[model samples]
Target chain A: MKNEDKDLTRRKTIGWILRAGIGAVIAAIVVKTSRRSSGGRLVWQIDPRKCIQCGKCETACVLQQSAVKCVHGIQMCGYCKLCFGYFKPDAPRLDEAAENQICPTGALIRKFIEPPYFEYTVDEDLCTGCGLCVKGCTNFGNGSLYLQVRHDICVNCNACRIAEVCPSDAFVQVPENDPYLLKELLPRET
Target chain B: MRSNILENCMLNIGYWILAAVAMAAPLTLTAASRFPQPEFDSGYVAHKMPHPAPDFAVTPMMDILILVVALCIAVVLVRKVRSRNWILFFGLICLGWFGFIRNGCFCPIGTIQNVALSLFTGVRLPLVMGLFFAVPLIFSLLSGRVFCSVICPLGALQELFIVKPLRMPKSLDATLRIIPLIVLSVGIVCAVNGAGFIICRTDPFVGIFRQSAALPMLLTGMGVLLVGTVVARPYCRYFCPYGVLLEICSLISWKQVELTSNECINCRLCVGMCPVDAIEAPRPALSDKVRGRQFKQFLYLLVFLPIIILAGAGVGHLAGAGVAQLHPGVMLVEKWQSVEEHDEDLFPSIEAFKRSGGTIEQAKMQAAEIVGRFREGCMYSGVFIGLILGLRLLVLSKLQGRKVHQASRSRCVACGRCFSVCPNK
Candidate 1:
């Protein structure tokens, strides 16, 4: 009986020690794994330069509506009313209306300047991917508006659905390594 | 019985710890080095699918090959096939191709997990974590613990730790099953809640299997593995969310590894030998018709196919675009580009550009382009989600014996005829 008790005690002690060791190991791995800094592996990547910002992403996407929304690049704007990006080649009238306004969201807020000159700004919260504004800007004004994949919500599938349907073919598949493919512009352009 | 139970409990714990330690060592080294890229990972811009870390992937492939060879040998042990030549052919492939090189570069499970975690949590856990979760679950479900039988590094490590095999109390073993479920549930909840990936933080098996990341909770995972070595794959048996999924999948899995009843001669050796308790004691044979119908019933879960697709589309729509908010890595990109910092200037110029249509040479055109592409991507995401869910359901449904007779199973008997002639059999 005494021998049996000693054996049992030995097993119990060993078990406890083993359990402690396991705990330490798992802690170590989690600590190690979490610390690794590999970059994101996003499937839907955009080239800011290639994007004409036609806003096809808003309409052509397979979602019920569209997940594409408008975003801004603040550094490069002159903000003029004959705003090459927003206005038609020849305007019947300059007043804001469904026909005159390039943006579907009425997201563009115009500030008055001298006659025939106005500054416009985008209400990002309201801007959808309907590229009415982008098309207007690129064709008539500076090509400021461009499309991008909002990494926050992108599913990043192996094969991107938008890439297949894109009329412009602007999308490209980024490698699992160094996922982001942000657009680069010349110093003068920015 | 008491002594056996005691020994089983001790051994089980030992095995768990051993496996956990083995898995953890490499991962810890990685963590200390700021999680350096695996040697095989191609850092080229074109390679978007994350590669599995070398330590985790390479070791397991070898182990799996070894197991396949052993099983083939066992197959020869039980059944005498008239086409002995075919057996040699199969043995070579099983030992060479499948055993050595897993054909697929990225395991499906890993991709699914990465996408899922990115959606739910705001962080992109290392792509390896996703694969780590996937490999075992895929193998166990499709091939019946073939992963456990052969290629899992943690499993192999635990075998070394286990000094003795002892009978454990069924009640205790049964109770431990809850661990994996709890772990899985917590992981999912944490992921969805945007709290963090519990799997990454507390994955006990990964510590022993792969070196992916470094989180504070790895210590706990290691402890769990050490305990498992003596106890017999406590993670697989009780705590792996992927394991639970594999268990559900095994219900309809077409392929299974087992000993034939005819050749068994009532020997119970295999039963005791199974480390994870996956084997079932042979029961009285049920009528083929009943078995067929039961199989058909299992397949009925596929009807929800369209619903799954629609749900994904609908949810994708509601979730809105801009995956950056949901994934920290994307957020990092936003930071790198300074999107939020210059919001005031960026918004107006882009807005003006959209208003103008490139008459101006300002940054507005760039902004306009970005907005346009993002919208389209969102739409495609919805469609893709819908299609995937629909197809998954369809496949699950189709698996349910849609036809009264199957080409694979319609043979003369559960006979060794096809088994003998087949290369993969």
Candidate 2:
């Protein structure tokens, strides 16, 4: 009977020690995550330059129309009348005909700017991040159009599909402040 | 030079400390880092060199809290708490919180791939992630698989749906048990070779958590959940790659998690209680001659381990070429440069490359980089699988005469079901 009592006591002590170890690990996890989690709520976004015009942002996202939207740099645009982004590459004319658009969704809206230049702006709701217009512009004209994660629509899935399938790996977790990487003037190379 | 060394050490320490805190939250702990290039666009025409330190991603600190609570709950269930219903109720709560609320992102099961990736690819591992991956395995070694029995949400969810547990024959169970080993080997090989986390991509329960997945995956999850109503944690027994580590640890465990809190009465009441068919009936004593022959057979198999490992390596090398397609780089190369793998209307990866104007040369370079990693990793994974097979066979051949029905230490999940059936209670 004495031996049984002693065995029971030893088992209890061992259990207590195990419990203490678990407590310590839990405390460590709490301390670490809490300390790291204070700065700001950062969410996934695409860096325009790193984007390789992968249309995956449109299709891969769990959301029906992807949270990724095309953002045009207003300042970078030469505002050409024959906007490569607006008209298909082999279009008969530079005119804004619905049939001549390269964008499957026709999200790019053309506007009258100067005599030979026309400004193109993205329709945020219609922009599906298909990257067709961005591809066209980057390939032919000044690379003004780029994709960005629209925070309002993005669920910010822990694993961003665009990031996963991205050939260039352009997607990043950017702070909510300074969300968009806008266009800026550059020193042209001679 | 001394000062430089000290400074570098300090920086490294500080970086790790901060990284530990970052890993505390269950953000996607993917093996590879996202946003490879810091540049926004190649032709921004701005001062792009001085890229600001991107804001630290601050997700909810709920995952850490849940994990800690899970540990507490497992202890409570095992040591203090007596009621099985209460344990099931707690499992339901965990299923809701960890599964649906958190959406199962930083699952320890999936972290096996990340751990493997960090080992091979020099990916920086966060301290919290290392702890998360190690804790369950350690628990299994020191005590038993408390993690599988109670902690993991994936298992917890399955526990809730276990309405009528069925048993399978011992041979079939042994055959199915090898699957987790295969998955672990394949998962590690693909992850190390830059194929990304195939385990996470193909995770059966993730669909249940997200409330949204591809139709086929969602249906598969639903089907599994439905089957779980009768089969009792089929995935846990057969498919979970993470279970392989826990199973190994449990096999060599010092502390045993038996069926009862006290001595089992040998009443055979607890015989069919184990949901995953982990309990074994008392075996009649084997004659000395039969036991001697079995021992001899075991010795013969032991001598063949090296040959088995070499054969496994050979098979693994052959599979590496096929597995390389999991990497987008390899797929891109095959679609454009090699042009031998497919005859489709263009897979999404190829279509993405086309829009980006990616060249075949670039694809070839990417393919070579990925395939090169596989040349080393895949062969090792195969040898590991062979080692596992050899050891399992050796263990199977060993005969220990038994007088009492026993819980297979490696297979038992320690869910405390048989505890309720003890007549001593």
Candidate 3:
């Protein structure tokens, strides 16, 4: 072959090799990611039942604010003036006093609807997932307030800090499909 | 007798007091005696969390296959067939698969940030993201930007609206070319510092792909599509950081598309026809002595390239603080560091951190770490931009000896518009 023809042939061969190399690399990455995650996406979630209300969710999250959030099942709530979630057991009076408030951030807003009834509403912005209110409510009153991994806020880190520190082993690996394990949120069609 | 009357009055008052306490007790207890509060009278239930569509949720294996196929098609069309019609078919098919079926979010443009995050930070990006990021560059190395020519859904969608071609002023076009560099730099810096992907967030096509998005984002997507009708591949030419990467690789590519495979007859037919205006006419030849002098001058510029890069690094480091502020943690800490100054807009993250018992010192420390990463990212970005600019200058000064109408490898997307116009074909 002439010199120019030889150069063209050489360039073509190198191009083919480059193409093959790219293909192999892509295949390798796909296999590697699948193998690493066990062929399924790992989603971080909190189990309500086994949670000890240890207040670790507030601090252990990689995000400054933990993805774990405190949610109140309105159906489970009693709207009581002397709510165990809202007030200390030995509070001096049935009033919204600093000493009587159980939540550290005052996230639980107590609204007087009628003569004797006060509705407890959680301002999620103010809630830190400390679970002080959940603990107080679960122990003294009917278990209503609970902690759940808010899907929007959670980055779904591979290794969850809340899970590691959870005393009751409440954290469990669920598919990315059904992420949140809310106490009253349809129970995953079970 | 007086003691008996006093005892009688006390007994009567005590009975009335007891009655009042008994009556108020039931009313004080809100769901008073009920253990479980009754369900709402309206009988509303919480809705299930939205799930990815059945068609959209393909296996990882399928993702790789689709990517490989698209890449192959791009290669074959550019190097072998070189047909404009086939290229248009390829774009339409990609628009269906990547734009509608798979969703446009998982694109090379978006994945640029993913790869950057993976390299700079410990973000575990999806495997397909790595593929989408790499395949385009690999294709560009062998053939040129065939991926941008058709396989890229964002480009394909824009091409469909390329009705009336309008020439963007060369000055504005050149200045706007700096955007992709800045965008890539800012994206990497912000992502490394735990800020979310800025590119993906602002992706104009994502809203249309998903069929639903925030109102503002949807409007922006529509606006880009409208502008695309007049200006061909505005995002691909000006905004896509991945396109910038492809351009860099394509410059050193083995083979590239030309206006004509055979010799050009000095035809001005292809002039003023390029959407991106990548075509450059052959300049008049210079004498050997002057060429030698010009070559020496170019060498001096090459020697000065490193100094240019270092100066850029300095400028970047100065601007690094602004980049760091994009991060939520840094923003929150910077605002709430004093703790005494009640910040008006108390973000949810800030409030949560304060309530979580985290100290101002800890938040400040995290912010400093993020800022450090941003500074490092800025330095690297500055070096990158400076290197590209210097190389571009070097190439511009060198005279092309060829007399044929040749394609500008870096700017030609290989959309195959000039193929039919060629007499050799």
Of 2 and 3, the candidate ranking higher by DockQ: 3
Q: All candidates: CA RMSD in angstroms?
A: 26.8, 14.4, 10.8
Each prediction's DockQ against the real complex: 0.02, 0.07, 0.11
What DockQ does candidate 3 score? 0.11
Clashing pairs in 2: A49-B40, A49-B41, A81-A117
The local distance difference test score of each candidate is 0.44, 0.69, 0.71
Model 2 DockQ, alpha carbons vs. true complex: 0.07
- Best of the two (2, 3) by lDDT: 3
* TM-score of the second chain of model 1 compared to its true counterpart: 0.39
Chain B superposition TM-score per model: 0.39, 0.78, 0.82
For residues B147-232, could you state the per-residue lDDT of candidate 3 as single tens digits?
Answer: 88788888888888887778788788878888888888887776666676677666787668756555677788888888888888
lDDT at position A66, candidate 3: 74
| Better candidate number, 1 or 2, judged by DockQ | 2
Give the top-scoring candidate (TM-score): 2
What local lDDT does model 2 show for residue A79?
65
Tens-digit lDDT track of model 2 for B1-425: 78756754654464355345434634334211211212223233322212223232333334455576686677567656756676677777777766776567667887777677766656555455555676677667666677886778889878878899887777887788778877888788877765667787777778677676778778888788899998899888889988887887767665666666666668887877778777777776778999999989988999999989999899888877777777878877766654544542256566556546766677687788778677666788889989998888888775877777678887888787877877675
